[model samples]
Target: MKVAVMGAGAVGCYFAGMLARVGHQVALVGRPQHVEAFNTRGLRLETKAFDETIAVKASTDAAIAADAELVLFCVKSPDTETAGAQLAPHLAPDTLVLSLQNGTDNAERLRTVMAQPVAAAVVYVATEMAGPGHVKHHGRGELVIEPAAGSRDAADALVAAGVPTEISDNVRGELWLKLILNCAYNALSAIAQLPYGKLVEGPGIPEVIAQLVTECKAVAAAEGVTLADDVDSAVRKIVQTMPGQFSSTAQDLARGKPSEIDHLNGFIVARAQAHGLSAPANLTVHALVKLIESKAQ
Candidate 1:
């Protein structure tokens, strides 16, 4: 498969390298420096199992995706439309656009901007850009994608590349569940710049998490998202599963980069307004992150 990673960040480089490793032709479309680095020395893949360099095509221009059969759209939420629009004119009409981004609405937003079919996927991974053209995987890598017209074929190809995927109709529910967890922990983690384990151990942290989860559940229900009954269990599991983890948003903030805070908790707040419901907890988290975001810049 000829694959193009639309945003050559951590997730993009990691997945592109993986596909290239498995003998798929993958091109990473991103920043100029990253492209130069990859073209010079190949993408560095550092994982718990092994570390190696995998050579792949890298480009900054969106037109690099002109020949791609599969487009891995991995930009952050706020840039979804801009990124999609950049590639819109170049994307093939039959390209299977898999949104490997955070937040729930990226696929829909991409569909609107690109005028192409886009599929949503719940990304379950912890990856980071260690250096130019280098991707380091710290943890899980699986996907729960929604049932789109071409999703089965996309999943099969990803699975062939050793990427686990489950195609389902309840992907939105799953995305909301993840969003609930993010609203609860991501801001606090970013603000304190602490790992999940340490953050959860602080006094009143558990209470605040519970409150945030409750607020999210209320907001989701009002928005007609049918979440699983085990929301708290999922929330608690993130700490134990990724105790040493500083969330992506936390890492972004620490790196003085922009976060998708507006798309995560802020999205919840927007949905709350649409439903005529209040989401004080989510709104508070969004506002706090916004304040810190200003300082970060």
Candidate 2:
């Protein structure tokens, strides 16, 4: 299948490289630097098993998505509407758009500006851009995508290309679970510029994480999302699983780039308000991140 990755960030580059490695026609739409690097030297894919360069088409134009059978909408949550608008005119009638992003509502937000079929997907991968056109995989690479018009075929193609993908009916719940995990760590990591291991080591930090999870769970429950019983455990396990990794929000802040914190904890705060509930914990961190962002300007 012909695939177009719309953002070409860490997630986009990783998945695009995977499919391209398997001989699928793949094009990555991203910033000029990364696109230039990819066009000239191929994408360097680094993983534990092997490190190799995979040649794929790269462009800075959203118009590159014009003939793609599958389009991975991998922009940050804040860019959902803008990117969707840019991609809308370029997409073919039968194209399938998958939201492989951080937050829960990206797919819903993307749907507002486009006519193509959209599906929400949960990504469980640890990847980073080691450099321009270079993606380093740290760990797992499984996906759980919501059912859509051609999701089954998309999942099959993804699986055949070495990406483990599942079509899930409970993607909302899955998204909420992921949100809870982010709420527990991303802001704290950003504020302190610390990895999960060190962040949790601080006094009262674990309690603060627990408070955030409690508030997020209340909001998720209000939204009628049935999160797993082990959601708390899942949130706590991040420190053990990704001890050395700073949250994406931390990475964004350090690089002077905007983050998806609004869609993570801020989304919890908004939904809590909507349901006549309060997520003070989430609101506090969300406000802090926003303050830092404002001060950086």
Candidate 3:
């Protein structure tokens, strides 16, 4: 399959590299430096199993997706609409656009700008851009995606490329669960610049994570989302599974780039207000991260 990865950051590059490794035609649309690196020496994929450079095409232009059969919409939450618009004119009619993002509504946001079939995916992966055109994987690469027109085929391709995938009917709840996890850890990791295990080792951090998860659950309940019964276990598993992994928000802050805190914890705070509920934990962390971001401006 011919695939295009929009906003080819760490997550995008990982998937693009995996597909390319399996002999698929993969093209990446990203910044100039990574594009140059990709064209020069391919993508350096560092994983626990092995490290290899996989050859793939790269370009700064969204038109790189012109012939793509599958389009991985991997831009950050804030760039969803703009990036969608950039790629809108280039997509084929039958292209399956899977949103591999943090927020719950990125696929919906993308739909406003494009007429292609869009699916929302809950991505469970720990990866980071170690450097230009390089993606380092920490652990767990699986996707739970909502069904779309070509979603099954896409899932088959992803599974064949070593990415475990499942098609679920309740992606809204899945998205909420992922959001709750992000709220529980992303800000704490960002503020402390610590990995998951080390962040949890801090005094009072576990209590704070519990409070954030509770607040997020309340907001999600108010929104009529019925999350999994074992969300707490899932929260605990992050530290065990990806002990050395920093939250994506942490990576963003270290790079002095904007984070999706507004859509993670901030979204909970906003929804709590709409439902006449209080989310002080989420509010506090959201404010703190926003303050840090403000200084970065």
> Considering lDDT, which of the candidate structures 2 and 3 is the better prediction for this target?
3
Error of 3 at 63 (Å): 0.3
What would the per-residue lDDT of candidate 2 be over residues 1-297, giving only the tens digit for each residue? 999999998988888888888899998999999999999999999988889999888898999887899998899888889999999999887799999998888898888999999999988777889899899988778899999998999899999989999998999888888889988999999999998889999999999999999999898888899884378779767777788778889989998888899999999999999999988999999999999988778
lDDT of 2 at 259: 87
For 75-186, candidate 1 gives per-residue lDDT tens digits of: 8888899999999898778788989887878888888888667888887777888888888998878888888767888898888877888898898998888788888889
RMSD of 1: 1.5
TM-score of 1: 0.95
Clashing pairs in 3: none
- Tens-digit per-residue lDDT, 197-297, candidate 3: 99999999999999999888888888999895478999999999999999999999998989999999999998999999999999999999999998889
Model 2 C-alpha lDDT versus the unseen true structure:
0.90
How many backbone clashes are present in model 3? 0
What ordering of candidates by lDDT runs from best to worst? 3, 2, 1
The segments of candidate 3 whose C-alpha lies over 4 angstroms from its true place after superposition are none
Minimum summed lDDT over a 10-residue window in model 1 is located at: 220-229
TM-score of each: 0.95, 0.96, 0.99
Q: What is candidate 3's local distance difference test score?
A: 0.93
